[model samples]
Target: MMGERILPGSYFQYPPPGFPSVSPHRPSSIPTDLERVYIRGKGSVKDSVKEEKLKDKPGFEHLNEPLHVLVEAELPKDVINSRLDYVVAILENLLKPVDESLDNYKKQQLRELALLNGTLREESPRMSPTMSPSMSPFNGTGMKRANYFSQKPLI
Candidate 1:
């Protein structure tokens, strides 16, 4: 029930580039996924997937798979992404000065998970000066460079 259509060929696709290929009607033509499936073939992603599984080895058939979008498609008016909801909780935990017994460690673990999952990234410490170079100066990082030969001041 999302307002926008997600994938191609659930309905007719309006690909301007592919129009040239499928324009002239043919008498003896078979629809291919690339050419016709994207143009005229109206098939649900779920049905296509179900057909694929039938060709799989016996006992390898998928049971009770969660198909996010397609065949037997009946979605409610509202959908909430639980992962995104959890992300809000993660941000709150990371931001607030939580001092409970395991709170700090829990936040640390959450931060690591967010970073590794590519859900979030560390913002640059020195935010771009709001005003200007002349009006306001940048808060340069204080991380001192370490080296065997010599040391360079970070800021």
Candidate 2:
């Protein structure tokens, strides 16, 4: 089964370039506090040494200090409700122009539809008699009649 290998031995032995290799010195024991552990970015060994030196400096040392709690003052319910009402009034004022434009568009559409119906009604009487199959010249005739030519050919 090893002879018919789907992957080569070198694939398991070495990782691809730009990736970090597995550390040989990794401890078998697990740490109790995961939150205290700080993870470092994928950087060079020289960069890690430089960071350690910077941490030892007095100016950069304050970053290691514990964070302070921030206290916020509670807002009154009346002030919050007043702000919401002002926002709603502003939104309604903004939408008034849009509502007016939409109303004008709807009126224009109704006027156009009325004009179209008026034209159709005026043209209907002239179209109705011509459109019927029984009113056609060829309806009673057994032979097909050529309406365009004056005389029928001796075919």
Candidate 3:
């Protein structure tokens, strides 16, 4: 026969009265029905001292469900870390655009291209008799024909 020792209730689960530091030995000022009807009268009064005192009591409206508990139960460490990073990234994105730093670079590149295209179009009309098919910058430039036609002014 395996004689196993049984643990006390206090060993596993601590009740309100068990934890003296948390549970108050004294009674609360939230009056009983008779006390409210007779002693306190019709109108209710706020007892700040009692309210503050009650807040320190055990089971003083402490939520059973905490976010950390859920996170620990459902998600692994790596998954949690990844999700945390993703949330941080999303928050950063919402606060600022995704391509914020690249905006200036993109704008500068666009400006440079516009200048190059403008110069090319301007120089296209001034082609002399010496300018051959190979000499033409527009010919076989690999740029789309539509881009040249759209930007190129009719002579």
Candidate 4:
């Protein structure tokens, strides 16, 4: 009876204003948050009015873990020294004689320098190549004349 009341041609007319007859759903790959909302026949509407839409969403908190550089393989050892005991011994043998010779030469040179500079008395017992003739114990007055003892009278 109701179908007979409405004209058959009226059934094919467009849906009432602000209502869609059938709506097609979007695929899952599309994100819900977008700058524009699209309709099939009409291009799109600006989504600037969505500030309130996001007000109820949860806020994100920062995680506490430290950031680090990525590495592909294990690091190599960083040892700083060589381990041969003979190297130390060889160094000792090579170094000791030179150091000893240097010290001995320094002492001898300092002694000779002191004698040359006259800090040492000329009468001091040290004999040197540049010592004066009078300074030597082997010189004229330094040697005693052979003592002639009168044990018996000379003829």
TM-score of 2: 0.15
Per-residue lDDT over 1-155 for candidate 4, one digit per residue giving the tens place of the 0 to 100 score:
00001112121244243221111242221222211112211111124244334334453111111211111111223311121222233322322333433554435545666776778544456667587778677777675666678446577
Cα lDDT tens digits, model 2, 1-155, are: 00110111232233344222222132211121211112222231236567566765666553344321111222355454444344334323322333433554334444555676674233334346447755544458433765767877778
- Candidate 3: tens digits of C-alpha lDDT, residues 1-155: 11111112232133232221111222222222211111111111146566456554675432222111011112454454554444434323322333534554334444555675675233457467687767666668533455675576777
Worst 10 residues of 1 by lDDT: 31-40
- lDDT minimum window of 10 residues, candidate 4: 1-10
- What's the C-alpha lDDT at position 48 in model 4? 28
Relative to the unseen true structure, what is the C-alpha lDDT of residue 11 in candidate 2, on a scale of 0 to 100?
24
lDDT value for candidate 4? 0.32
Error of 4 at 24 (Å): 99
lDDT of 1 by residue, 1-155 (tens): 32222222312334232121212232112222112211112232336676565535464332233221211222344532332333334333333444455454545555666876779776555646364444332334433455646756566
The TM-scores of all predictions, comma-separated, are 0.18, 0.15, 0.17, 0.16
lDDT (CA) per prediction: 0.35, 0.35, 0.34, 0.32
Worst 10 residues of 2 by lDDT: 1-10
- Candidates 2 and 3 compared: the better one by lDDT is 2
Most TM-score-accurate candidate: 1
